[model samples]
Target chain A: MIPYLIISPYIIFFLIFIAFPVLFSIFLTFNKWNIISPMQFSGFKNYIRLFQDALFFKSIYNTFIFLAINIPLQIVIALFLAEILNQKIKFRGFFRAAFFLPVVVSGVVVTILWQQLYGFDTGLLNRILVSLGFGRIGWLIDPKLAMPSIAIMATWKNVGLYIVLFLVGFQTVPKQYYEAADLEGASHWQKFFKITMPMINPTIFLVVILSTVGGFSLFIEPYILTGGGPLNSTLSAVLYIYKEGFFYYHMGYASTLGLFFALIIVSVVVIQKKFIEKEV
Target chain B: MKKTIIYTILIFGAIMFLYPFLLMITASIAPENEISKLTLLPSSISLNSYKQVFSKVPMGRAFINSLIVSSTITLGVLVFGSMVGYALSRLEFKGRNLVFYIIIFTMTLPFQITLIPQYIIMVKLGWVDTYLALIVPYLMNALGIIMFRQYFKAIPQDLIDAARIDGCGELRIIFRILWPNALPALVTVGIITFMGSWNEVLWPLIVIRDQNLMTMPQMVTLFVLGGRSEGQLGLKLASAVSLALPIAIAYMFFQKYFIQSIASTGIKG
Candidate 1:
C-alpha cells in the first residue's frame, strides 16, 4: 500500500542506472577528465571550445543535411505506401509485414546491407549503374555523396516504421467522407489533398518530429559505412559526440556538445508542438 | 487498370525490400570472385563461407551471448515493467503522478548523453566486458513502464476492488486479476524490448571487447566495420545472413503482433 516500500526496487534501479548516469554526464560536461586522470572543472570552456571545433560544425552540417534529404523522401514514400496499404487490397497482411521487416532487424544488418550495396567496386549500386550504361558512381568515397548515401540507407531502413504510422493515421479518416466525395466526382488527387491530407496532418507532424530527432541522432550507419569518412563528410553530431566522449576521452566537451544538441532537440520539438497547436 | 498498377508498384517495392536478403544469401553461397561478377544467380553453391565465418569468428559464442543477454533483459523488463506499470496505474499512492512524469522525462534523454556515464558507472562497478554491463542497466525501460501503465489503467477498477474485498492480497490481485487482463500489453512490451535488446549494436560494441562476449549485432558490426582479418566477401555475407535469419523468422511468425504492438505505442502521444 505504501509508495516507497512498493516501488523502492524500481526507484533504486532507475536512480542508480538512469538518473545517476544522466546527472554524472551533466557534471562531466563542466569538467575536463580523461578516464585515467583526475577531473578539472572548466565551466563553459568546453562549450566555448565546442563552438571553435570545425569538425563539430561540419558534423552539425552533415546531421542537418541528413535530415533535409531523408525526412521528405521518407515521408512521401511512407505516406504513399500507407495510402496504398489502407486500400481494401489483397495480400494486405503480406504487404504490411514485408514493408515492416526492416524495423525489427538490427541496425547493423541494415547498415551492412546498404554498405555492400553502396560499395565502390563490388557493390550492387556500382554494378547496376555500370550495367545501365552509366559510369560507376562513387557512393561512399566522394565527400559530396557520402551524407546523401547515408541518408538513402537511413530512409530505406526507416520508411517501414513511418508507413505503419501513416497507415494508422489514414484509417482514422471516416470512410463516409470519402464515399460522399466519391459521389461528387472527386478525383483521387482531390480526395487525397482535400480530405486525407488534412486528416493525417497530425500524423505527418509527429513523423517529422520523430524522424528529425532520429536523423540528428544517427551514428552506426555512417560509423560502419564510411567511418565518418571522405574527410568526415558523413560524420553526424552524435558520432562526433561519441568520438569525443568515448574515443578521445574528452568527456566534458562531449557533454557540452550533448547539452547543446539536447537544447536544439527541445526547441525543435517545442516549435513543432506550437505549429501543430496552430493547425488544430 | 488501377488495380494492376497498384499491384505492380507494391510487388516491385516488396522486391526492393526483400532483394538485399536474397542477395546476401546467394552471395554467401557464391565463390569470392563471383561476388563482383554480374549475375543475380550463384554459379555454384557452397557452405564454405558459412563454415569459415563460424570457425574464424566466435559465431556460436556470439549467438549464445546475444540470446542470453537479450533474453535476460526481456525477462527483467517484462517482470519489472509490468510491476511498475501495475503500481503506477492501480496502487493509490501519493507520488504516483511524480513517478509517472519522471519516467516519461527519462524517455526524452537521448541514450548517447547517458552512454558515457553509464559506461563509467559500469567500469567503476567492475562490470565491463561482463554480461552484467549489458543486462543490468537496460532492465527498467521508462517507455515500457509508461506504456504498460497506460494499458493497465484501462482495466476497470471494480475488478481490483472485487479482488481485494474477496480477501486476496495486493500481489494476488495483481497476478491473478490485473496481469491476465494485461497480457496483450505485456506481450507488446515484451516483443519490443526483446527486439530492442537483440538489435542493439553500439552499447555492446563499446562495453564488451571479448570476442566470446560479443552479441550478434555487435559481431556483425565488427565484421562490417572491417575488424575481421580475412575480409572474404562470402564469409562476411554469411555472417550477415546468420545475424539476420533468426530475427527474420521471428518477425514472420509474429508479424501481426509486431504491427499492432508497435502501432499501439508508436502512435500514442
Candidate 2:
C-alpha cells in the first residue's frame, strides 16, 4: 500500500496524459471535430483524405530528402570530429564545447539565426559567396534549395550530439586491438575501418536511427526559416500535422496524419535496425 | 605535421560551428548599417535593436513566465518523479514491472501522435492560455524517472535496509538518504528536464495563445515570425539573443557535466 501510494502520482499521470491521450488520438482519427464544434462520426473520411493528400505526401517526401542528406552528413562529420577529439589533443574540451554550443541553445534561436545566414540578398552565406565572386544562391527562397538548406541547418543544430555519442563509442573499442593492429603493420585507415568500425557498429546503428527520428520530426527550422514555403518544399511531416490541427483546426484529420506518421516512423526504425544493426 | 593537419581541421570545424553565433551576436548590435554585413567584428556597436525588442514585446513577462513554468515543472519532476522512481527501484510492490514497462513504451512513442489529443484535452478542460496547460502534462518526465530508478538500483541495498531498521519511512529514506547520494542523476535529469522545457516551442504554441503566458521559445519564435519585429533584421536577431543568452551562460559554466550527461543519455535514447 505504501509503495502503491508512492507510485500513484505517476500512475495517475500516465493514465491521464499518456494512456488516455494515446487511445484518444487513435479514436480521434474516426471523428470529425473542430475544437469549437461537437465531434461527428466520420467513418474513414479522415484516413481517406490523407491517402489522397498531395501536400501531405510532399511533406513526407521532403522529410525523406532531409533524412537522405542529413543522416549521412551528420554521421560522417560527427564520427570524424569524435575521432579527432578522442585523440590526445590540445584544448579538446574547448573544441567539444564549441561544437556543442548550438545543441544547448534554443532551436528557434538557431533557426532564426540560420534564416539570416541563409538570406539570399543580405545573409552572411551569400554575402561571403558574392565577396568570393560566386553567384548568389537562394538558401531558403528557392524550392530546390529550401529543404536541403534546412537539412544542413538541422545537421548543424544536432551533429554535436552525435559527436559525443561517437566519442563514447570510440572509448568502448579496446586499446589492445589498436596496439595489435599497429604491431601487424596495418595502416591508420585500415585500423579504423577494420578494428574501430566493426567494434562500434552498434553506435553507428544508434546514430543512424537517432538521426532518422530527428530528421522525421523536423519542424522548427522549416517553420521559422521558411514556414514550409518555396512551394511547400520544406513542409515537414510534423509541421504539416501542426498546421492541420492548429492553423485549420481540423483536429480529426490532423490525428489521422499523426497516426500514419507514427506508423511510418516506427516501421522505418524497425527497418533501420534490421539493416544497420547487422551481426558482425 | 599530422598534429598540424588535425588542428587545422578541428579549428575549421569549430569555426563552422561557432561563426554563425558570433555573427548573430555582433550583428544584433551592429549599428543598422553593419547589421547585414558578413563580418564577425562589428565596426560600431548599438543597443537600439535590443531596446526595440524589449519595448515592443513583453520580453520581461515572457522571461518570468518561462522561469515559473520551467522551474515549477523541474521541481515537480524532481520530487514526484523521484518518489515514483524510488518506489519502483526499492519498494516491493505488485504491478512494478508493469509500471516500468509502460514508462519505457511511452517514452519511445513520439509526442506528435499525441499532440492533437493533448490539445483537445487542454481545450476541453478550459486549460488553454493557462499555466496549468503547460505545467501539468509535463509535470513529470519519464526520462527523469528512469534515470532515478537506474541510479537507485546501483546503490547497495543495505543503505535502505539500515534506514528501514532505524525506523525511517520509505518517503524519508528517499528524500534524505538516497536522494542526497544520487546527486549526479539528480543533476543530469534536472538539466535535461530544465533545458527541454526551456527549449520547447511546439507544445506551448498549441496550448498557449495569450502573449502574457508565452514561454521564451514560443515568444521569440512568434515575435520574430509574427512580423512584430517589422523587418528589422537586427531586432529579429536581438529577440533571438535573449533566448540564446541563458543557455550560453549555463553551458559556459557547466560544459563538462553538460557534455557528459547529454551524451550519456543520447546513447540510451
Candidate 3:
C-alpha cells in the first residue's frame, strides 16, 4: 500500500499518457480522425497509403541520410575531442563546457541561429566563402545542400553530448592498457583502435543507438528552418507526422505514420543491439 | 613537441563551437544594416532590437511562462520521482518489480508514439491552451525515477533502517534522510526535467495557440516564422538570444551538472 501510494501519481500519468496513448494510438491507426470531426473507421487505408507515399519514403530516407552523416561524424569528432581532452590538458573542463554550450539551449534557438548562419546570401558561411575566393554555397537553399546542412548542424548541436559520454567511457578504461601499448611501441592510431576502441565498445554501441533514435525524431531543425521544404528534402518522419496530424489534421494517418516510425526505430535499435551487443 | 598540435587543434575546435554564439550576440546588438555582415565584431552596438522585442512583443510573458512551467515541472519531478524511487528502492512491497519495469519500459518508449493520442487526451479534457496542457502531462518523468532509484540503492540499508527505527515514515524518510543525500541526483534530474520542459517545442506548438500562454521557444518560433521578425534580422536574433542566453549562461557556470545530466540520460538513449 505504501509503495503503491508513492507511485500512484506515476501510475495515473502512465495510464493516461503512456499506456493509454500507446493503445489508443493503435486504435487510431485503424480509424480516421481529425480531432474536430468524428473518428470514422478507416481500416487498412493508412498503412496502405504509407506503402505508396513517396514523400513519406523520402522523409525516412532523408532521416537515414542524416543518421549516416551525423552518427559517424558525431562519433569520430566526439571520440577525437574526448581522446585529447581526456589526457592531461589545460582548461579541460572549460574546453568541454565550450563544446557543450549549444546543447543546453533550446533546439529552436539553435535551429533559428543556424538558419541565420545557413542563409544563402546573407549567411556567414557563404559570406566567408565569397571572401575566401570560393563560390557562394547554398547551405540550406539547395535541396542537395539542405539535408546535409541540417545534419551538420544537428551534429554540432549534439556532439558535445557524445563527447561527454565518450569521456565517461574513457575514464573507465584502465591506464595500464595504454601504458603497455606505449611499451610495445604502438602508434597513436594503433592504441586508439586496439586499446581504446575495443574497451569502449559498449559506449560506442550506446552512442550509435542514441544517435539513431535521435536522428529518427528530427523535427525542430527542419520544422523551423525549412518547413520540410526546398523539394521536401528536409522532411523528417516525425515532422511529416506532425504536419499530417496538426497542419492538415490527418489524425488517423499521422497516428499510423507514428506507429510505423516507432516500429522502424525499435527494430533498428534491436538489430543494432544484436549486432553490437553480441561483441560485448 | 606533440603538445602544441593538440592545444592548437583544441583551440580551433573551441572557436568553432563558440563562434556562432559570438555572432548571435553581436548581431542581436548590431545596428540593422550591420546585422547581416559576417564579421564577429559589430561596427556599432545598439539595443534597438532588444527594445523592439520587449515593447512590441510578449517576450517577457513567454519567459515568465517558461519559468513557471519549467520550475513547476522540475519541483514536481523531484518530489514525485523521489518518492516513487525511494519506495521502490527501500520498501519491500508487492508489484515493486512490476512498477520498476514499467518505468524502464516507458524510458524506451519514444514521445512520438504518444504525441497524437496525448494531444487528444488533452483536447478531450479541455486542457489545450492552458498551463495544465503544458505542465500536467510531463509533471512526472520516468528517467527521474530510475535515477533516484539507482541513487537510493547506493545508500546503506542501515540509514533507512535507522530512519525507520526513529519513527520516520516513508515520506519522512525520503524527504529528510534520503533527499539531502541525493543532492547530486536531485540536481541532475532537476536539470534534465527543467531543460526538457524548457526546451520542449512540439507539444507546446501543438497545444499552445495563444501567444500570451506560449513558452519562450514556442513563442520565439512563432515570432520568427510568423512573419513578425521578417527582414528584421536584429530583432529575430534578439528574440533567439533572449530565448537562449539564460540557459546557456547557466550551463557555463554549472556545466558539470549539465554534462552529468546528459551522460546519465545517455544511458537511457
Which number leads on TM-score? 2
Backbone clashes in model 2, listed as residue pairs: none
Provide per-model DockQ scores. 0.63, 0.78, 0.76
Model 1 agreement with the true structure over B154-225: per-residue lDDT tens digits: 989899889989998766776788778888887888888888888888788778988889999888778756
The CAPRI category of model 2 is: medium
lDDT by residue for model 2 (A1-280), tens: 8999998899899888988988999999999988787889999999899999999899889989999999899989998888889889999989999999888998898898888878888777888899999999988888998999988898898899989988889889999999999999999889888998899988888888888888778888888888899899999999999999999999999999998899999999998888775666
Candidate 2 structure quality by residue, lDDT tens digits, B1-269: 99999999999999999988888899898998878674678888899999999999899899999999999988988998789889888888889999999989987898779999989889889999999999999898788889999999999988989999999998999999998999999888888888888888889988999999999999999988888988888988899999999878998999888888888788312
**Residue B102 alpha-carbon offset, candidate 1, angstroms:** 0.8
| TM-scores computed on chain B for all candidates | 0.93, 0.96, 0.96
- What does candidate 3's lDDT look like per residue over A16-88, in tens digits? 9899999999999999888888889988998899999999889889998899899899999999999999889
Model 2 spans with C-alpha error above 4 angstroms: B267-269
Candidate 3 residue runs with Cα over 4 Å from true position: A278-280, B267-269
Local accuracy of candidate 3 as per-residue lDDT tens digits, B1-269 = 79999999999999998888888998899888887774678888889999998877789999999999999999999999998888888888888999888998998897778899999999999999999999998888788888899999999989988989999999999999998898999998988888888888888999999888999999888888887876588888899999988788788778888889878787312
Alpha carbon RMSD to native, model 2: 1.4
lDDT of 1 by residue, A1-280 (tens): 5546657778999889888888898898889988788889888888788889899889878888888889899989998998888787999888888888877777788887787889888788898898899998899999999999888888888788889998889889999999999999999979998999888888888888887788777888888888898899998878888888778988788877877787777787788788877886
RMSD of each: 2.0, 1.4, 1.5
Alpha-carbon local distance difference test for all models:
0.83, 0.88, 0.88
Arrange candidates, best DockQ first.
2, 3, 1
